[model samples]
Target: MKFGDIIVAMSIIAIVIIIIIPVPKSALDILLSFNISLALLILLISMYIEDSLQISIFPSLLLITTLFRLSLNISTTRYILSEADAGKVIEAFGEFVIRGNAVVGFIIFLIIVIIQFIVITKGAERVAEVAARFTLDAMPGKQMAIDADLNSGLISEEEARQRRKEIQREADFYGAMDGASKFVKGDAIASIVITIINIAAGFTIGIIINNMSFLEALNKYVLLTVGDGLVSQIPALLISTATGIVVTRAASDTNMGNDVLKQLFAYHRVMFIIGSVLLVLGLLTPLPNIPYIILSSSFFLIGYQIHSRLKISTEEEKEIAEEAEVEEVKSPENVMSLLKVEDIELEFGYGIIPLADANQGGDLLDRIVMIRRQIALELGIIVPMVRLRDNIQLNPNEYVVKIKGIEISKGEVLFDHYLAMNPGTAEGDIEGVETTEPAFGLPAKWITEEEREKAEVLGYTVVDPPSVISTHLTEIIKRHAHELLNRQDVKKLIDNVKEEHPALVDEVVPNVLSIGEIQKVLANLLKENISIRDMVTILETLADNAPITRDPDILTEHVRQSMSRYITKKYTQGNKINVITLDGELEQLIMESINQTETGTHLTLDPNTIQRILNSLSMNVEKFTSIGEQPIVLTAPIVRIYFKRITEHAIKDLIVLSYNELEPSVEIQSLGMVTLK
Candidate 1:
């Protein structure tokens, strides 16, 4: 241990020694003065600390100081009964107060004890108990708030960790204080017992053993006992007051001193009212008018001074604000700052804030973190951090999800109601406000809490407001995953891959294709709902095909075929894959219309033919949807890209796959053939 630790340990040992060993009067006087000084110092420090956690060591300190005071009381009591002199400190206190009246001195000592035990110590103990209970109770909510901030990207991981530590420390501190207050109470009772014993024992020893008279013994012993009690009780009172201050303190940037002044004197009118009350009392009461007159005049003067200072402070603040405005107008950077946009933002109206607030039992932030992880696992894309904020301009029940400053999807949720979606096979109709599900365009209803069990009995999927919004956000992000990917994201992916596949990345990147080209390939795969998580296979496929074609579209097709097993497993059900195919005549016509250029390939099919193809595809897709099967259009490998491009705008959720992208073990169940009449 360091020297400081050694000193603290030795000091505690000394306090224990003081209880068992006799001390000289001079030494006792020095220790008594030191004890008083220590208590005063602690009180001053407590007043200056902004937060109770900042002085977390106070509970332990309280225990040590209490022990120290008790040890001194014991040592002084020993000398008073045996030697008739406790210390100069005690003797001086007795002489200063008792003069010749021991009764007055005893009463004063009793008053100090009563104040410390009944008022300060009791109040502090109560506050500490309440604080500890509430701190423990609020721990879960506080932890959730930290997690929420972390998920919302409002605080970094390090900050979140620090905040969590602070919360735990606060709980521990308050709990310690709750136990430590007992030590003070015990010390108070001990002092009273020790003082009584000192007086009784000293009187017996002096009158019976030393041959002194009863009155003389009483005069000497009573004065010494009262002095010793006064000396101990005064410091005890100070320490108790300090304990109260520390436990009752709130977290703030300002210390207790400044906070008290600011809150107490914030309004000058309070002082004015006090002055008026004092003036009225002085006029009506029978007490001396001079003291009240002086007090009221002081109050009026202080009030005027405070009012003037407030006015000056306001004017200075206005001047500073005006200067800031002028500076902001002149700065070009400030003007340009307005044009900056967030990558992804979730803007909710006022009514939806409670769903995001952790204190109100909202887990939206935690859900957002899960959504990001889910996207990364499903699509192999590290989604940008989503920023959540409140926007009053939108309707109270509405929320908008935006990407790159443009709105992608918007939805409304009733905060107090659950969205109950009817499963197709549900038996009975339930009473609720009819509405459309925000995440999917499914028919749903907003039902009250009491109707939740009834809705479930009817085979409805019940979801809360936060779940509805989060589900919609997750889907929106998945659909726009390609748009969210940038060259930076590709670079990060490559860096991550370098750890495991170093040689693969070093050879392919900047050797055959640039990061931008790789980004395009990833985007292309994401656009088709393909997970690029198998980076090694994708890179190897690109390495093999880069020499054959520099086009990203063609490269993506090559990667897709390589990942055919992964793709087929995702959409395949058991051994059968339901599919829609193009007729041989239509396929031949599409092949003839394909044109290759320096930029890329293009399909030159007539608009009428495209319309006819779309109508037929739509009919088949609807038939597949009605049967609860997702429609996948199967086409020849050569025309797959062209066919997907032609139908993408007209069919939102259509899945177009080439024959080469299917697994060999899978059986293709042809549902229908698309042919123009």
Candidate 2:
């Protein structure tokens, strides 16, 4: 064991022994002096700590100190009764306080005990109890705030963990202090009882055993008894005051002494007013003029000096700020900071501010939070924080959604109005301003509050202005989710999956394919609105086929085939799907035009043939839409990915599937076929 640890252990054992063993008067005096010194040190330490957690061990320390004081009282009582003296320290304390009068000295000792027990100890105990309760009550809120910051990327996982640990430590410290405060109270009561016993027993012993007269015994033992009480009570009072200071302390950047000096004298005007009041009282009232005049003059001098120093410092600060501003403009880091772009941003005009402001009863901010959570559940990728700010450059009712600093889509909403769109089944017409829905480009109208109910009754879908903007933003994010999936996001997904399937992640991540390759495959899936939440299957598929070809496109096709049941359930209704099929000639044509290179595969078909293929596919896709079914094209497994890529620009919402990427239980009905007609 370390030397300090050994000494602490030995000292505690010796303190317990001191209560039983007889000690020489000289050694008792030294031990008594040490007790007073230790109390003083504890008081100083309590005053300097910035936070209660800094002295988390104080509860245990308080118990030990109280025990030590009681032990000393026992030892002193033994000596005063048997030897007619406790030690020089106790004797000196008695002589200093008694001053030839025992009653007055004894009364002063009682006053100190009352103050320590009734005022300081009682107040500290109550504050500790309240503090402990408040700390425990606020723990849930503090933990939630940490989690919010972690999810929003404002703090790292390590930082969140540290904050949670500090919160727990604070709760533990206050709880222990609540119980430790009772020790101080108990020690005070014990001290009073012990002092009374010392006087009564010593008085009896002195007269009978030492052959002293009544008056002589009364004077001798009373003096020694009072001295012993003073010696013990003084240290007790100091420690009680320390206990109060510790429980009441709050977290701060500086120690208690500095905080007091700064906060108490924060306003120079208060000092000036005090000085004026004192000056008037000294001149007009019958109070002692000299003392008041001296104090008033000192206050006025200090206030004037403080005002002058503040003025000088303010000017110096302004000059330093100007210089720093110029230097900041010249710094490279400032320029670099300006280049940092958010992953997603929602900018709206002043009229739409209420939709994002919680104070205005707008739940757009809340809706955006739900949007992020929904995307995570559906796509299995964490969406970054969506920055919302008002833009003065746009119209009052206009809003724009941006991805990676570029505007992707913009929409307009009328405040205090609802947008109503017909779903091809509305039987009646509604009077409102005509508009096109930004999310789906369907014809809609801005209707008044009274017209909202009427429109809904006529089979029209109605939504509030905030919902209109929220839906538009949600669609824009979903469309561009592929662009947002980077290597870092892929790594986070891999780490999450690693918690469950460590060996699968280890085999597929860096060994079979790198993070960039995995990111590309996930992006491919997201581009088609496929959910990557089933990460284990995705990793397993990659582990099987990644060695054959490092192409992300090929790997993604393998993953899709493996997730046939999920895709079938997503698109099929009533165990049936209506889709367009590629003709045998068209499939063979695509297979022939496929060109391979070192980087990856590509289609080298001539422009004329591509346009003819697009025209034929467009005609076949229109047949499904005419029958109220979604446009799905069924092609061979080898040509499905290439066909989707070829028509992505011409047909944005096309769903091209392979025959193998379907459940056998579902029936596929081909409504038409794309042919080279």
Identify the leading candidate in terms of TM-score.
2
CA displacement after TM-score superposition, residue 396 of candidate 1 (Å): 8.2
| lDDT tens per residue, model 1, 242-266 | 9999988887799988998888878
Global lDDT scores for all candidate models: 0.90, 0.89
Question: Which pairs clash in model 2?
Answer: none
lDDT of 2 at 621: 76
Superposed model 2: Cα runs more than 4 Å off: 1-38, 51-102, 129-236, 246-252, 266-269, 359-363, 421-432, 447-462, 499-501, 573-578
Give the per-residue Cα lDDT of candidate 2 at 544: 95
Q: How much is 551 displaced in model 1, in angstroms? A: 14
Score every model by TM-score.
0.70, 0.84
